[model samples]
Target: MAFGIMMLFVAILCAIAVIREVKERNFLAVGFAGISFLVFGWFSVMTIFVSGAPEM
Candidate 1:
């Protein structure tokens, strides 16, 4: 649960960075934003499907 929230925040930050990079025309920052978005998305999916507690 916490991880998902963290990832969501990260995704928002990355999205902002991506927009900034586009405005500044920085390829590196754009690439980083893309990677961050991918990672954030993966974590979001994991958080949704993975159980938070041990199965009983």
Candidate 2:
């Protein structure tokens, strides 16, 4: 659940960054947005695959 929240936060931040980049006409912001999305995806996948409890 924490990871999910983190992903949401990153997504919101990315959206804000993209909007700012569009207004400022900066291409580097787009790169940062891309990296943020990749990190979000990675965290989501890890959260799904990694369980807190071990299965016997």
Candidate 1 lDDT tens digits, 1-56: 88787888888888898999999999998998989988897887688568465677
How far residue 7's Cα lies from its native spot in candidate 2, in Å, is 1.8
For candidate 2, lDDT tens digit of each residue in 1-56? 67766776777787788778878888898788867867786776577566433667
At residue 55, what lDDT does model 1 achieve? 75
Best by TM-score: 1
Look at candidate 1 and tell me the lDDT of residue 9: 84
lDDT of each: 0.84, 0.73
- Report residue 14 deviation for candidate 2 (angstroms): 1.0
Give the C-alpha lDDT of model 2: 0.73
Model 2 Cα displacement at 46 (Å)?
Answer: 8.4
Off by over 4 Å in 1: 52-56
lDDT score for candidate 1 against the true structure: 0.84
Cα misplacement distance, residue 24 of candidate 1 (Å): 0.2
Q: What TM-score, over all chains together, does every model reach?
A: 0.75, 0.56
